[model samples]
Target: MDNRFNFSVPDICDDHADKVQVSNLRLQSFGGNDTFSGPIETINCPDDNSLVKEILNTPGKNRVLVIDAKGVSHASMVGDQIAAKAESNNWNGIVVNGYVRDTEVLKTIPLGIYAIGSIPKKTDKHGLGSIGNDVFVGGILIQSGNWLYIDSNGWVIAKNELKF
Candidate 1:
């Protein structure tokens, strides 16, 4: 599980121009690994990360968690513990549509974490959130099982897996 995904977003786009959806959001990278690719898994955790923790605890071999925090920054939905679990369970990466805490530890984990920003506050853990739901980020609709390619240049969404 050592950054198993290896591919370039720009190269993939050039080859699959008609099959990709590029995101406009400029999310910051906090994890050690900068690039990753995997099948998508959606979550809706607006102001709460209970379900986020739940999902990361499960097996995540070659999958990415796409969290829809309703584009909010007041409450952090993903932090070190949750992200650590993700890396431990072999998750390729995480794309949070909200903020994340533990900026320091997050940068050390060997997982890909792209977030809007970082905060110091954690979620209330009210167990509020939905799983396997479709999420919208950067005006692009991302559904479960969709392929995602993320790198330093940017992230790209494809309806299906593309050959690198």
Candidate 2:
């Protein structure tokens, strides 16, 4: 595999399209961990937890989960259970534009999980939402097929994978 876009790990998306393409006001990379890359899988929902199960059950070998958490400041979209599931399922990483819980446990998992912040609150198990669809986050348009690169520096997206 050529891994065309396999350039230097630290790169920036200079292309601007109206929206800024990042929204979680306080969530930041756990540290300088450059642990996520690859195609995007989006989830745009509120109070829905079924998709979390679906994605966890599926194979995420090298895929990144791009979650549109609707900026739920009061609740956490994921926690220890979800993170453990993702790790067991081989998910490369999870990027949530919302809150998450069990921060201490998450730091121990091998999987990469990025979120807006950690809250003790949890979400409703409505099992309601759509997967593998288009979503607008970070002030940018992000579809299922788009490529996303996430690291401690922040996240950058593009219609197609960018090559160096």
Candidate 3:
């Protein structure tokens, strides 16, 4: 009945490669936690962070929020305040498919934050984008409720929590 994932990404690849889907994007670590794992929550928000903000307001329940920002380089879907809110709400991790702002502050947060890069441009809050949707990025198809595991090596997703 234990759901804790203490296994490393490399070990998972070596032992359970066929059972997990790995992300091709080389996401930079921006949070205090280098290793984290939990069920996935998806957001397809590009150029706007309304959905991101909205979701972060709710209880995370130890879930990881996967955001598909369309790899937008100009606008950041996450920032210091948003990330802090997520941490305060108990989100296990956040994997951004786009850029983020406040790099230094993001690193202090106690969670896993993997993003393509950083930018100073903040996104608009148009309340646009869909939640609980499939996010395709870096040759991986991420859906809500999928389990995501991140370690110092990299990230890997599975349909359910892996027990090792």
Candidate 4:
């Protein structure tokens, strides 16, 4: 899957400011692929990553998972194992509102990963979460099926697909 986008967030915003919502959170990129854009798939889970694991297990071509971890600062919502699975499953990227773990291994994955920070603690596996829902992250309302553009500059979302 060719997940690369030629345009940067600033350029996209400049061209489509009225159509895009820029993320306010300062996200750190951890995956190997720095630029990725695709339709959004959202997960709302506060401190549990069970649904995240399940979602990564499925095929993820041309899609990016937007996880709303409810800004949990302690527990890590994603780690190396889940990220590896996402890469293997052909996921373009993952945007986590909270924290991630295994920062070293995360950088090796081919998928794009943007997170608020890193944590050593893993999340609970109680399988408590909802998928395919509207999730608010970084002061923006990211809904399932919305288009997401991400790069070193920042993250942006559009209601419909846009071409550069």
Candidates in order, TM-scores: namely 0.95, 0.82, 0.95, 0.96
As a whole number from 0 to 100, the lDDT of residue 41 in candidate 2 is: 86
lDDT per residue as tens, model 3, 40-144: 999999999999999998999999999999999998888999999999999998999999889999999997888999999999888899999888987899889
Better of 2 and 4 by TM-score: 4
Off by over 4 Å in 4: 1-3
Local distance difference test values of all predictions, in order? 0.90, 0.70, 0.89, 0.91
Kindly list the per-residue Cα lDDT of model 2 for residues 51-96, writing each as its tens digit.
Answer: 8767877887677788888877788878888888887886777888
Candidate 1 error regions (>4 Å): 1-4
For model 1, residues 19-107, the per-residue Cα lDDT tens digits are 99999988989998899988999998898899999999999977999999988888898889999999999999999999999999999
Error of 3 at 12 (Å): 0.7
Clashing pairs in 2: 21-138, 22-138, 27-116
Better candidate by TM-score, 1 or 4: 4
lDDT score, candidate 2: 0.70
Q: How close is candidate 1 to the true structure, as a TM-score?
A: 0.95
